[model samples]
Target: MINLYEVQETNKMIEESNLDVRTITMGISLLDCCDTDVDKVCENIYNKITTQAKNLVSTGCEIENEFGIPIVNKRISVTPISLVGGSCCKTTDDYVKIAKALDRAALEVGVNFLGGYSALVSKGMTDSDRLLIESIPKALASTERVCSSVNVGSTKTGIDMDAVKLLGEKILETAELTKDADSLGCAKLVVFCNAPDDNPFMAGAFHGVTEGDAVINVGVSGPGVVKRALEKVRGEDFGTLCETIKKTAFKVTRVGQLVAQEASKRLNVPFGIIDLSLAPTPAVGDSVAEILEEIGLESVGAPGTTAALALLNDQVKKGGVMASSYVGGLSGAFIPVSEDQGMIDAVEANALTLEKLEAMTCVCSVGLDMIAIPGDTKATTISGIIADEMAIGMINQKTTAVRLIPVIGKDVGEMVEFGGLLGYAPVMPVNRFGCDAFVNRGGRIPAPIHSFKN
Candidate 1:
């Protein structure tokens, strides 16, 4: 284990490759903060979060300087607001008050984003869940750092088409509400099927009810490092390619483990899982698609792309599991269109389509992420797409999500700039064919047969 060569290689990865910790998310439970008075609920959670996460950003900076590794974002994840506002919160406006409080707390703590402006309606929508979903547009438009998610489907429970239909309308409204900012509000909204409890990455991270009071989750990133490793083994056999990726993921995850342990100890919080996801950014060479291209594909969306992604996703998991005892969340390859330079290029070149991306999500970690669509796209059609992706996750028993941003007043072939990290993307067109009838008939699609194995 004491090898100078391995240590030197790790250093090179940090120096040369765009290797870094994507986020150090502190999950804080807001259950105990719940109160019948909406204002009291807001005050309680805000005070709790501000007091608990006061040192989060500063600590992350200290760690980055000490270890000489970059920590891109420091975030907070609280309990799903639906649970906290269950009997206490009355109307959509009441929930919006809570959202503003979350935004204040995030700014106070100096964190980039604060997740858990969320509801879990996989089985059915409760009164609070309905109120929260209805208020998404206003809540998101009014806040700066708050992120929201709605779980409309899960493996144990069939897809909630009612929630899907409603969320489709909400998403379109959110875009319209933030049209001046390229519909940025929709960018912070995610619809998930079987959404994880401990995911550190957002637009979808919520500290589930089962989670403890507080904890630390680290999401690791190193797609550039994997792509670089593949360069040395160019034209190699499949075995060699897989092995190379495995070793690269191992090294990347090992660093995440170190960072997670340090953050947990410094904060006096329990160490949560290390999410070894190959999360790419807008930066060049730091792309999951580039790693696919290096695997002999001319372009990322070319034929056989799905097979290539399947291999890469599997190998990353294999290499990561051994490096960290607790590897959870969506610990696989991410293919966000706007966030990955290669993916954005492919979309612009007309090489990638909405249909192809949906097909690819079957094997990748997330579904239809950061794909900007024409503003005129019908709400029913968006719901239909969510229904399809939800079915995929429900049937396969995998965590799948949809974060389609329909830029208001924009059409296909137009570009919408969401600025840093979120990057920008050309609005891709969707099939206008009528899925109106299917999505309009709202009810739960029964859980798959395998889910009946009790």
Candidate 2:
């Protein structure tokens, strides 16, 4: 199991190819923290999360130093707050208090972000779910480290158009509340369809009701490594290109597996899955868009982009599954404009448009992500966009999400800096044609016919 050559290769990837563990997320279930009283629920949630994740950040640093691998973020995910506050949170303010409790716990444990300020209402919204969702704008506006998500559609339960319509309004409210920070609160909120139970990514990760009390899930990324490998086979045939990507992905996943195992053993938490997503960053070389360009496209949004992305996504999953038995989450390439320099370049060059990006989401890892629009865009337009993406995920039976920021006081071509790993983005224009009538007719869109397997 110990080989010098493999070790040297890994080191080279780390030092040159931008290989790094994206995040090591600890999923902590907060179901046991629920109580009949609001105060008790807050106390229980704070105590549980702090106790469970006390050593998370330190352990991550320890692993990084020992292995000489970069661990970018240490995060925690708790069970959806809607469920945890069902019995006790009778008002929106009650739910906001729970969010404050979660934020305090995150700070006490030294994690950068804490997820699971979430509500799952794929088919229908319960009273508690509605309350938590309604409180998101204030909750995010008030907290520093808390992130929120709402699952409004799934293959089995169809899309909850009611929730979709409500989220459109809430998202705008969130933007206005955080307008001073360039509407940063909207960046921390996500709307999902067919959301997975164990995604380690931010703005979307939550400890699903099905998971255990505690587990360690690691997300590994290497878009730069994949692009560099592709460069070696420039002009090679499709088969050669595919093989190169597969072999490279296998190697990368192995590194994540090692880290996940080590983190689990050290933290005494059971190992979850390894998410081998080609999650790009603002760094020059670490871009999924560049990898597509290397695949013979003149630019990322040009013809054959979807085919190129689909091929890459499929091969990555194939290779990742071979490296580890439990490969889960959004295990494919992510295309976020702010996070990836190449995508931002494409947007500035006028080669990538909102329509093109939406088409690409059909094949990429997640849906339209980290995109900023004008401050004056209508709430109905946002709801329409969310409905379209949700329909895609429900029909395809794959995880899809939207993290759009309607930057307050910003318009087309204006840049909003989110800073750090979130990078920056130009405010892209959305279609002005109204969808008021379509969005106003609210009810569940029935599950696809293919969902009748039972």
Candidate 3:
């Protein structure tokens, strides 16, 4: 049972801070949907999604209304289609059809985004995986709500240099294909290291083979709630702030666990993980950067911000782990530049830079998310950013990702509005220094030593 003081503090956090549940993701495995015939496979894919996820949005809305807590996104993650399409597709066109099927299913189900239009090429790419990656640009340009991701590196498998190189080319292709659409296609793609299959977040979620046939995963968010809690102890020392955040996170994640368990029971699906990430939206109060500012930083990129973020991430995880049996995904604070108003302000004020944002990614949840760079930024630079983040995740053995958008024809300080949940981002500068040699090396960075144990 929760204590009265704790409940009061939690409510106070929600009242004062920007607090709301970010996403309630349902993971539906599609391994059983695989078939030798392309049409049958597509049919199975559609049937499985529509059948298993029919109640997802309605249930999420019901829970939101019952608890008075907003659930920002109700999403579905399925088995990586590359694996499912492996036996069926000999050419890239087959992959395109699969992408279309996914889009149709998502539209029918009224989901905001459907993930697992992805492939895990960390170790190596199968023929279908390569074909799927090759067709991403066309697939993304043709589809509406289908998000894509590629795991090019992991702690155990090391980095797949060939896949990384191909991904760089794919990024360039994706950028060019959707250049006219405000570069919206790139917004749907993510490159990850140590990516999790149970992740309910967009642009980088999939159903891992280890998961059950169907499950319910919850991603609870409350940056505003955390900020409000910190504001209550405005003049308090750092120790008190950390304590406050941990206590608040405990309550938030507890709600998430309860909601997830109930949803799973109601849906007759297994209970999946709770991703305790402070995923912010473009709303007024739901900003992760605001949480940092409440901790006394003048702005998000100010000095000592990283340390503060480190503490917040750690405490959120600590509190969340204690609250639930299974805690997974990028379970920390998300600082997507365009999605958070405070982050956008920080970027416009020159308080944040690409380099500084990269630095912050080292301590927080995801890396280089929703960042819009000049359209002319070289593919090598994009790859360089990816390599740098992958190196960080590789070294730390933690999950980190890059979801950057090269806004075509947009220069520094310019804004590209994606509208809706994607929001808008100011065009940020990228490293002018040519990393041609480093990225051109075009060889796999071997797995870390830590991965070799046993």
Order of the predicted models by TM-score, top scorer first:
2, 1, 3
Per-residue lDDT tens digits of candidate 1, residues 1-454? 6388977887899889999999999999999998889889989988999999999999999999998889999999999999999877788999999999999999999998999999999989988899999999999999999999999999999999999999999999999999999999999999999999999999899998888999999999999999999999999999999999999899999999999999999999999899999999999889998999999888888999999999999999999999999999899999999999999999999889989998999998989999999998899989999999999999999999999999988999999999989999999999989899899887899988899877
What is the model-wide C-alpha lDDT for candidate 3?
Answer: 0.87
**Regions of candidate 1 where Cα sits further than 4 Å from its true position:** 1-3
- For all candidates in order, the CA lDDT equals 0.94, 0.95, 0.87
Query: What tens-digit string does per-residue lDDT give for candidate 2 at 123-217?
Result: 99999999999999999999999999999999999999999999999999999999999999999999999888899999899999999999999
Among these predictions, the greatest lDDT belongs to 2
- lDDT at residue 23 of model 2 (Cα atoms): 98
Model 2 weakest 10-residue run by lDDT: 297-306
Enumerate clash totals for all models, in the order shown.
0, 0, 3
Q: What is the per-residue lDDT of model 3 for residues 280-337, given as tens digits with 9 covering 90 to 100?
A: 8898988888888888899989998898889999999988888899998889999899
**Candidate with more favorable, higher lDDT: 1 or 2:** 2
lDDT of 1 at 57: 93
**Against the hidden reference, what TM-scores do the models get?**
0.99, 0.99, 0.96
Model 3, residue 411: what's the lDDT? 90
Ten-residue segment with the worst summed lDDT in candidate 3?
10-19
